[model samples]
Target chain A: DQQVKQNSPSLSVQEGRISILNCDYTNSMFDYFLWYKKYPAEGPTFLISISSIKDKNEDGRFTVFLNKSAKHLSLHIVPSQPGDSAVYFCAASGTNAGNMLTFGGGTRLMVKP
Target chain B: GAGVSQSPSNKVTEKGKDVELRCDPISGHTALYWYRQSLGQGLEFLIYFQGNSAPDKSGLPSDRFSAERTGGSVSTLTIQRTQQEDSAVYLCASSLDVGTAVYEQYFGPGTRLTVT
Candidate 1:
């Protein structure tokens, strides 16, 4: 059972434009959510994260928005750059668990110039 | 200092063989995790070690897959009698603590294991 799910398999955005990737989760117990960027043949790098108590958290050009009621979260990249093109995976953590992250299938983002 | 690093960038082994993958975590990071990545599937948790605490092997797929952490720093994941489906990129990560916003897990390039 995939607790975290990214419905979109892929997304395309124009350079310098805004890009939005959406993710959903089935478990309401998750308290912390994070987004990671992964390149080909490389490990995923942490981008940003948000807590359930907060609705949004921003870091540089990346912002994560969380809606507890909807069990939905989104990662927004402003002025999307070509370098930002990679697979984006959404992960979650709960207080009960010892921070054993649960990751989604990931969404492939492509930025076109 | 340097981030997490994994050895044996690529390994090709025959079926029914045994393979060992290694991971060196970052300095001062007590929490270590192992994950398996397969095509179309995201990171699958394999095992984790935290300080002197008992390791969590709940995510391990089967009895054939096992891991160990020595001196609470480096870890080794061993797969015995591996099947073709066991072929996947094995990734290792290190974090500061558990269930905290400080979960900025630094990851390694990963060891690509191909079971023929």
Candidate 2:
């Protein structure tokens, strides 16, 4: 029984275009959501995060939107560049459970030139 | 000034063997965690340790998997009677604390274990 889920396994977008990655969770207790970017042979690094209180959060070209009622969230990156090509994972943490972050499978994003 | 370091970046071992993976976390960080990532599988929690409290081992898959943290700094994950199913990339991370509603988790280069 996976709590967090990333329905898409792979996504491709043209450079300078917008890339959208989606994720959903079954656990209603999840309050804090985060996105991680991973490169081959490297660990997943924290990219951005949003609290349940807010519906959206944005940093530079990266924006994260959360729909608590639907238990869905999406990450939007505008003007996607080649350097953005990597595996992106969605994770969530709650207050009840030891603040442990449960991660989704991940979506491989390929920005084509 | 190191984020996190793991020894033996890659290891290949035969089935029924035993192996140990080490992790060194950042200084003054009292929280440490172990997670495993199989091919096409999401990262799974293995264990977690804080300052002297009972570790949350609920995530451990089985008894064959065990870990220990010394002085709340370094940690070692030991797997006994390794099985082919155990092959995966083991990752270690450290945070300030758990259950604090914090989203910052620092990770280290994982140790790829291949069991034949």
Candidate 3:
């Protein structure tokens, strides 16, 4: 069972525009959520994260918004650049879970310059 | 300040053969995890090791799949009698520790295994 799901398999946006990636989870026990960016033939790199208690967290041009009631969270990249094109994965872990993360299928973002 | 590293970046093995993949976690990091990613699929948890505690092999697909962490530093994942379906990229990650605090996991480039 996939606890975390990224419904959109791919997204395309113009450079300098806003890019929004969405993720949903079924398990309410998950307390921490994170986003990772992955390029071809490379490992995923950490992007940003948010706690269950917080609704939003921002880092530089990336922002993550969480809605506990909806079991939904989103990653927003402002002024999206061509370099932002990659697969973004949403992962979650609960307390005492030993940091074992459940990752989503990932959304492929393409920024056209 | 090296990140996680995996050996044999690419492996091509025939069916019924056995393959062992290795992972070297970051120095001083006590948590290690193994995951498999198939084409067009998300990462699948395989196993986890934390300090000297018992390893969590709950996510292992079958008895043919196993992992071992030696000295709490390097880890090895073995897949015996590999099948064509066993083809995938095996990824290794390490984190400082596990607790209430959210620990970011650093991943290696991964070992791409192809079972022919």
Candidate 4:
């Protein structure tokens, strides 16, 4: 079963606009969440993360918001740039999981110039 | 400083043959993990190792799959009796778990294995 799910397979946004990618989880044990950006032939690189203790975390142009009650999270990129275009994966882990991450299918984000 | 490194970026083997993939984690990292991504699928956890502790092999699909981490630095994943269904991009990641509550894992360029 897919504990983590990215319902949208892809997203497109014009440059300088905001891009939002959503993810949902079914496992209550998942307390930590992370987002990774990947390009073709490259490994997924860590972008941002949020803990169940906090509702949000931000890094530069990227912000991750988590809603524990709903078991959902979203990554927001403001003033999106073409360089942001890539596949974004949402992953979750909990103390019970012991450092292993459960990843979503990934959402391809296209930032138009 | 070098990040995680993996060998044989691409490997093609015939069916029924065995293949071994290697991963060299970043220096001083105490946590290592193996994951694979099949076609049109998400990353699937395979195994995990942490500082001389028992390895987590629950994710291994079958007894034909196994991994070993020597000296707590390099890890090798061996797949026996390869099948076309075993084709996927195998990825390795590592993190520093010493005295840290939250660890961020750094990944290596995956090794794409094709079984024909």
Which parts of model 3 have CA positions greater than 4 angstroms off? A96-98
Query: Of the candidates shown, which would achieve the greatest DockQ relative to the real structure?
Result: 3
Question: What are the clashing pairs of model 4?
Answer: none
- The CA lDDT of each predicted structure is 0.92, 0.91, 0.95, 0.94
CA displacement after TM-score superposition, residue A12 of candidate 1 (Å)? 0.6
What is the Å distance of residue A18 in model 4 from its true position? 0.7
Q: What C-alpha root-mean-square deviation, in Å, does candidate 3 show against the real structure?
A: 0.9
Q: What is the docking quality class of candidate 1?
A: medium
| Docking model 2 quality class | medium
How far off is residue B80 in model 2, in Å? 0.6
lDDT tens readout by residue for model 3, A1-113: 78999999999999999999999999988999999999999989999999999999999999999999999999999999999999999999977554799999999999999
Pairs with steric clashes in candidate 3: none
Cand. 3 Cα-lDDT: 0.95
Ordered by TM-score, highest first, the candidates read 3, 4, 1, 2
Native contact fraction, candidates in order: 0.62, 0.69, 0.76, 0.71
Off by over 4 Å in 1: B98-102
- Residue by residue across B1-116, what tens digits does model 1's lDDT show? 89999989999999999999999999999999999899788999889888889999999999999999999899999999989999999999998874444477889999999988
Q: What is the fnat value (0 to 1) for candidate 4? A: 0.71
Q: Higher lDDT: candidate 2 or 4? A: 4
